[model samples]
Target: MTEVTEAGVSKAGVDEAKAAMREIFPETPLQMNEHLSRRYGADIWLKREDLSPVRSYKIRGAFNFFRKAIAAGAKDRTFVCASAGNHAQGFAFVCRHFEVPGVVFMPVTTPQQKIDKTRMFGGKFITIRLIGDIFDQCYAAARKHVEETGGMMVPPFDDRDIIEGQATVAAEIVDQLPEGVIPDLVILPVGGGGLSSGTTGYLKDVVAPENFIFTEPEGAPSLKKSLLAGEPITLAKLDNFVDGAAVARIGDLNFAALKTFSADQVMLMPENAICVTITEMLNVEGVVLEPAGALSITVLEALGREKLAGKTVVCVVSGGNFDFERLPDVKERAMRYAGVKKYFILRLPQRPGALRDFLNLLGPDDDIARFEYLKKSARNFGSILIGIETANPENFAGLVERFETAGLGYEDITENEILANLVI
Candidate 1:
């Protein structure tokens, strides 16, 4: 591995980024979070990137990229990009700020809410191209457009300027802390490694944080895998539940700064566990965080109460580009993570008393969330899909015990992805 001596972004880069980005949007807040501090036994603070003009930190990178591009005699150029969420929105806003013509390509499946917000932000400065069902397809279409039209392409997170821009967040974090005060730990969300790589690069020389935890969706551990193998690797499949932080491969340049960290520092957070954090922040803190934004907080459970007790920690709340349409899915995942929901496929006899026998097994706190007869055998058997929700997760264990005692044939489908995709 080539050891790059952090010629990359840093505190100095943040100052440069700030001067350049001031034309776009002001710095986001790095505020103390009382609620989290009290719960985790730490002096916790939140870098509220979610409060930026675009409700994300993407604007910093986009602005810096555009500024550098324009300075290099590209003012007459049209900019293009592909993104379905916060990045695209930031690009549009930056295009509008510079009064430059830009085109944004997004997946066809992107929610209307995001599409509308992007349009509103860009106004007449940008054009929206809905091209493919998936991100890679849209990305290809955008690159082709840029190639054919002689326009500049603004990558979401891979560019040098983008990393420098994101490093500005670290500047805000340092400035917000009192003199002679440095956090013992810093938790950051890793998607394509732009934000994490940028922030860590900046902080490395200034402060040797006692610990650094990188939170990636379990479905996408690109950084962890890349560091383990000594090179970037593409994931064959990626679950988009944590859409904002789900990346198939960490960016080459971003990983250059990131590979210095050990694999243990990268924490893989479950998608469902993230939902719990999202809901908690929304309901308790009245802070609406998208899945990616909640990544740091969600991994707190793994830190264990003992390690976190009486320490100064900072968690970056990445973005708040959440679509309310996903609320049902988020709630369902939260319920499952909290151990209040389960799904099962029950094999039933054709006898009239079979349904009654199963009903008698459920505890008083158990409620049938879903029930459907999925299959039937002509004379003797049937297949039923059942979903149970309870006051607590332990209730399902008792329900399972009763099913076994009664000699019932059943399959727990709660964690079955293939079966879940078919019906759930």
Candidate 2:
């Protein structure tokens, strides 16, 4: 199929997809954000997909899938899916809307909160099954069940139907833009590339995709690695912190849809930096954003003032299914990335007044967030675990200087993943 056709989902087809969803939910807002716009010297509009009924754009795809399947007289067939997060909730909500029987397969290790939310969304319309220890195993079981029962399986981001369903997001973005205002750049967060591919297809006529920038989490750079290698490649390792957009590999159909794009268009955002964005949005704007949801906005800093000056930019805020229970973790990561927090193992002289001397060296703005005597390594030296938070990142220069002047031996463990994960 020609790129313009989008594997047969045209712009009109995208509009039709949008119309199909009016029965269940309204169009999401595309508000011009004054805060971001002023900060970056650009007119920044946010395509807030986080505002959907399911608190994400996932519902749009699932709802469209159900509509098309039911229209084809497949409503009587049992539907199935395998997911532990947003996709599951989306599928469940769509199942209830159509009054269709459905099943969701999730890993045994999936968090209880996710399981309960999926059950709540599906209600009486769906059944939950916990299988296997990881996603791949659970997904295999889901596929096997589909084969045995001839049930339809709703894939997360790997099918033409799912991509077509996601294309509706672009249609809405076009409809929502202010009169006579054309977007200079469109920032999209990429995972399996469903949203990016779908939106790219829909915007072929309306906007030049040369203006597009796609972002993925640094630890899970499937798309970027794939693009650089000139084909889709699986990541050697995956980080589930940005769960929504942290895929080990890009989907076949979705990759095909985006293969023509240059590798340079795709950028990687550090997972820690994304957490910083999350915390900043929560504290400064009263906006709660999951790491993936904040991807598009967070990458703006990487673009800096030169590229964004006097331009109109649109950022797609994909999902906001953040759990407040993870707030402390998020804050810790944010503080580290911003350089205002540090963890260190100080080789303190074993003396009655060593702690007092260390405390005196810290400035008024510096606070000892965590202090623990790890071990008495020698007769003369003890290892102390210390976590310090300062008002400014620059304060670290002064801190290290003070330590050297006092002849205090220290090792910063703030960026030491293995130790930080174990202790902090």
* Candidate with maximal TM-score: 2
Per-residue accuracy of model 2 over 164-240 as CA lDDT, tens digit each:
88888888998899788889999999988889999988888777879999999998999888888888899879999
Residue 308 of model 2, lDDT score: 97
TM-score of each: 0.94, 0.98
Q: Please provide, for model 1 over 1-424, each residue's C-alpha lDDT reduced to its tens digit, 9 standing for 90 to 100.
A: 4322252654665677777777666678778888888888788888999999999889888988988899898989999999999999999998888899999999999998899999999999999999999999999999999989999999989888898888888878887888888888899999998888788877876667337889999999899989899999999889898989999999999888877789889999999999998888989999999999999988777787688898888899999888888888899999988989988988999998989988999999999999999988556989999989999888888999999999999999888889887987
**How far does residue 170 in candidate 1 sit from its true spot (Å)?**
0.3
Query: Which residues of candidate 1, in runs, are more than 4 Å off?
Result: 1-7
